[model samples]
Target chain A: MACMNEDGQWIVLMGLLTALGLFFLALIINQSALVGQTTAEGVLEFPKNDIRDLRSEIFDVYDSYGTLHAQGRLGDVEEDIIRISLERKNAVVHFGNDTPQDVSGRDLHPVTIHYNNGVTEYDEIVYY
Target chain B: MVNDSGQLYTMEGVAAGVIMLLTAYIVISTTSIYTPGDTHIPDMQLEQLGSDVLAMMDTPDREGGTSQLVGFVKNGTETCGGNDLRNEFLTNCKMRAGDEDTKLRAQVYLSYRRTDGTVNTTPLSLPDPEFTGRENAVRVTRWVQLDGILPGIPDIEHSSRPRAVLVEVLLWRA
Candidate 1:
């Protein structure tokens, strides 16, 4: 009888120990999941710079305007001025009376270039 | 008769031993205990904070028909009175007007754990456009580290444990 009682006590102790170990294992897993969630969320918050190149292109166009003004090749200074404006899907460059008379074809200086869609047009307006 | 008394004593001893073992396990597990398999709690906290900061950076503020990225950090204030962790964090952020260009302002808060197990909080304002500007905000990028250890956790000599989280916010206004 004494031996049986001792064995029973040992079995109960072993069972308690196992239960505690399992509990800790579960806690560790829960903590891991929480950490994973945070890391994933942080990864999503990072910013992207897709428009940087486009902005630089716009600046280049502005710089070209300055260069054209400095060069004497442009004739009829009063009427050949060009102004660029951005529309919904295209960049419109309005040509004044000062525009070059020989301007034509792909060789014509394009004041505006549509980035999203491939469309380019020069509008000439002569003010009386 | 002697056999019965001895059995009872043995049973009591075993019961007491088991109870003590369980109590010790609970105490160790609950307090000042570090396990190799435990998850990186500080890393997780930093990650969450980084996300909140990024989200604030992404938000657009409208002024004079132009949308701008405006971020303000206020500490110990109820600016963003909400229960969400992100909102709570924002509420602690403060923004101040300084210099000729208000668009180039930044508010930063630093939190460090002290030796007495208390948190020491500090507020810092970045020099106008020093850390970020309209260009930086427009081109802001973010990256996070995924290692077992966390950055700035108390008293564990694992400083180089690749557990540091970094949040970079670019400021831009158009």
Candidate 2:
């Protein structure tokens, strides 16, 4: 009877400890689910405005291609894009327009644009 | 001393109460709830799609002819012919890489500086009937530098000089 008296107390303590451990484990699992979902959600929310603004600036340079290239100002614009991308956006960007080629009856310049922002990378060879 | 036989039952009751309290608190606190409106992910996706469609339409397939977007802006009048712009926008937006269709609607507006050097907005596309003042919409804008006067709708009397007009399209999904 003396052994039984203290033995049941130990059993109740052990059961309580196990219950607490399971509760903690469940909490950890609940939080881990959120971590994965937020990561994928962030990727889905792409920096679309940034890409659009970059494309617009590139085309703006293209629009003034003749004067800017002749004045060597195009080099400065390109350098600005690369430098700012590295400093502010944490991206590496490079774009170039090849010699004009005939595509479907129009003399269009083939522009190759490469953009990588660590998380996402986009490459395009669009005719403009 | 009195027999402590009921002490074990009292301890059991306390233990069960503590466990129940803890589980109730944890369950209430950790109920992970999510709503689509809480996250701006859908809005971001729709905005990106709208901007991409506008950019593509602005780009001329060839060098000489006017871009579809520019032509639409130049020829557009108040309350007329915006249907074409809306239709063309939907046509491009609905075409996905996997040929999936998205249900989206848009209202287009043009922002320009008048001769008095003030900005003005004129509607190019009418809003849909479903736009009952509560739908969430995103506005996508593009700059279109017009070389000549906007042909129709003499509300502000624009000059023949080059005007940099902004094409703002308010897009929403049904």
TM-score of each: 0.25, 0.56
lDDT of 1 by residue, B19-110 (tens): 77667656655543333322344333334444445545434464322111112221112232111223333332223244332233233332
Which one wins on TM-score? 2
Which lDDT tens digits does candidate 1 get at residues A40-75? 444333211212223332333333444434653232
In the range B1-174, model 2's lDDT, one tens digit per residue, is 334367777678767867776786578555554544335666767888888888888888897666888787777763335667887888888887774566577888776655444456788776677777577787776766455556663364655544445677888876
TM-score of predicted structure 1: 0.25
* Per-model fnat list: 0.00, 0.01
Clash counts per candidate, in order, are 18, 0
Q: Write the per-residue lDDT of candidate 2 for residues A8-61, one digit (tens) a residue.
A: 565676687678767766875566456435654675546566566667757766
